[model samples]
Target chain A: MDIRKQFGANVRKHRQATGLSQEQFALQHDIDRTYVSGIERGKRNPTIVIVNKFAKALDVSIADLFDGCD
Target chain B: MDIRKQFGANVRKHRQATGLSQEQFALQHDIDRTYVSGIERGKRNPTIVIVNKFAKALDVSIADLFDGCD
Candidate 1:
């Protein structure tokens, strides 16, 4: 399986589940909307630093990010 | 506790556990020795890209990177 694509789908699913727009999620993580978009589109692979930031912003664990992506 | 420090210690511990020097680990991950050194010193926050590479090279899961650091 393509982890990046799976990860992107997971990101999109979680973002929608939280009722947050890409821009809102980005702001919550102190990142740019484009960055979030890039990740969701599998155009960029985030670093662990950014991943941790997402975990915190989403009030989820790192493992949660992989939910449904496996 | 500082996650950066904990991560650094974890990185160092795993490297030693595998009997790999920083340079060896770097080569395994296709990263530079200085980059690994910076991470081990908590001076650099690796992106998920590098983390995944390390996970693959170490023959471990991402969760393993957190072992003994929590």
Candidate 2:
């Protein structure tokens, strides 16, 4: 599968599930909104550190972001 | 937890389980041996693309590399 796109879709799913728009999620997570946008669109390739940050921000396991990706 | 360190350890564990040296693994994956070395040492910040490459090379899920990281 296309892991990046899957990851983006997963992130979007979780983020929306939390009732947080991209701007709110980015603000709460101290991430750039544009960066979050890029990530959610699968246009950004984030380092593991950033991935960890996303996992923490989303309150999900790193694996959760990769669900359906493998 | 130090996600990078945990990821490196997981990679090492999986790599060793496959009975392949870093050099061999790098060559087989078309990655730089030095980059692999850096990753195993927790000194590199690899993007998800590279992480996916490693997972594919090691025949593990991308989440497997971050197994204990979250």
Candidate 3:
């Protein structure tokens, strides 16, 4: 019910929809695989830097990433 | 020159333009002041959840936040 949980869930959905594994995503973004896992699990609070990397690597707009989370 | 630094600079610019301290902005968004500070300094990578909170707290579109960062 929390916003962060919703956001994380959305991220997981998108990542899976794109057919990219967490390791693949992290490698594309030059981040640790565990970091990507942590983010999907809501164990990490990524900064804007990480978000930008994700936006670029995932080929999604930041708006798209945050959409419907509200 | 990195996207993250640019994003952080934009964030700081917007925050200062609105005359908000990190604590005030974090309070408004129910985030930790230190977390907000970390974001401004490009030391943290906020998740989409945090970005949404920031977009709402700052009254700006997520697109606007990423607009010139690229």
Candidate 4:
């Protein structure tokens, strides 16, 4: 699988685990809802800074977001 | 220090530990050296795909790149 897609899947898993809708997640994290949607769909390439935002918003470590993808 | 700066410092630390110059590292990873420099300097926001490239190139995990940076 493409790494980006794997990453996106991981993100989706964790995001869903948090029980927030995509729009709610983005608004709570101060990220654009469309950007969040794009990332969840693996159509967007989110930067490390943005990755940090996701991690922070999700309350997970960067590694945690990537767990078991390999 | 800002988290981004901390992230940059961590990248520099791991990159240097590989004993490759920034240019060499970037070339080996197919990343632009200028982009690597910007990332190391906390001046660029690299996507998770790029971050994965850096982690793969540096022989580290995404978590490892962010160790002790909280």
Candidate 5:
């Protein structure tokens, strides 16, 4: 899969694992809901800062988000 | 260190391992030399696409770029 898609999938997986809907996740993380949606749909290309935010919110390493993406 | 700085250090490490100067590596990878320099200095916040490009150029996984970053 494309890295963006893979990242989106990973984000979705981790978010779901936390039992938070996209909106809830965004609210809790201080990220825009629409932006989160875009990211989850692979329609957005977030910078490393934003990626780090997601990793922090998800309690995962940056590497974990790209796991199995190769 | 910050993730961006760590990423820059990792990029520099990999690029040096390949025995290529920033200009030479940029020319070979079709990336802007100044952009590479910016990335290496952690002054640029690259999106995942650019990160993927670096990973591909370095023949490493996205995870590798982030190794020891956390």
Candidate 6:
């Protein structure tokens, strides 16, 4: 189901929904901005803990990231 | 939120719910039983893609892995 793309799109959606830039998202999460870019592009494979971090930084839930992917 | 523990516990729950042993679960997902053990113990970190794989193999949604872990 291209979960990477689905997850990435959901992450991007959450970021945008919160009105945060990639840089802001990265900063808030203490992750590198480039990594955030990679995640959004579905180029980076992040771990479950990392996904949880993204969810936290975006003020969303791990479940939320799988809105359509699931 | 101790996401690792939360996430790992959820994985164990899903695996148990499906009545699959560690080896069986590992075989279905093509992941190593030891690695699966690590993940289930919250000792290993998995990527989003791997998480998706687990969800698929468990016949559950990614969100289900995060039921009480918002």
**Highest DockQ model number:** 2
**Candidate 6 CAPRI grade:** medium
Summarize candidate 3's per-residue lDDT along B17-47 as a digit string, tens digits.
7897888877877888897787788776665
RMSD of each: 2.9, 0.9, 4.2, 2.1, 0.9, 1.8
Candidate 3 C-alpha lDDT tens digits along A24-54: 8778768898977877787776766666677
TM-score of chain A of each: 0.83, 0.94, 0.80, 0.87, 0.94, 0.89
- Considering lDDT, where higher is better, how would the candidates rank from best to worst? 5, 2, 6, 4, 1, 3
Q: Could you give the interface RMSD of each candidate, to one decimal? A: 3.2, 0.9, 3.1, 2.1, 1.0, 1.3
For model 5, state the Cα shift of residue B50 in Å. Answer: 0.3
lDDT tens digits, residue span A1-70, model 5: 8888989988989989999999999999889999999988888898988899999999998888887776
> For residues A1-70, what per-residue lDDT tens digits would candidate 2 score against the true structure?
5677888988899999999999999999889999999888998888999989998899999999988877
Ranking by DockQ: 2, 5, 6, 4, 3, 1
Instruction: Give the lowest summed-lDDT range of ten residues in model 6 chain B.
Output: B1-10
Quality of candidate 6 docking, DockQ: 0.78
> By the lDDT metric, which is better: model 3 or model 4?
4
Indicate which candidate wins on lDDT: 5
lDDT values, one for every candidate: 0.73, 0.89, 0.72, 0.80, 0.90, 0.83
Give me the displacement of residue A4 in model 1, in angstroms.
Answer: 3.4
Residues B1-70, candidate 6: write the lDDT tens digits: 5677777898998899888899998897789999889888888778777888888888888888777776
lDDT of the structure predicted as candidate 6: 0.83
Q: What is the lDDT of residue A17 in candidate 6?
A: 90
**Number of backbone-clashing residue pairs for each candidate, in the order shown:** 4, 0, 5, 3, 0, 4
Candidate 2 vs candidate 4: which has greater TM-score?
2
Question: Model 4 captures what fraction of native contacts?
Answer: 0.62
Q: For model 6, what is the error of residue B33's alpha carbon versus the real structure, in angstroms, after optimal superposition? A: 1.0
Please give each candidate's TM-score: 0.78, 0.96, 0.60, 0.83, 0.96, 0.88
lDDT of 5 by residue, B1-70 (tens): 8889989989999999999999999999999999999999988889998999999999988888888876
Q: How many backbone clashes does candidate 4 have?
A: 3
Model 1's TM-score against the true structure = 0.78
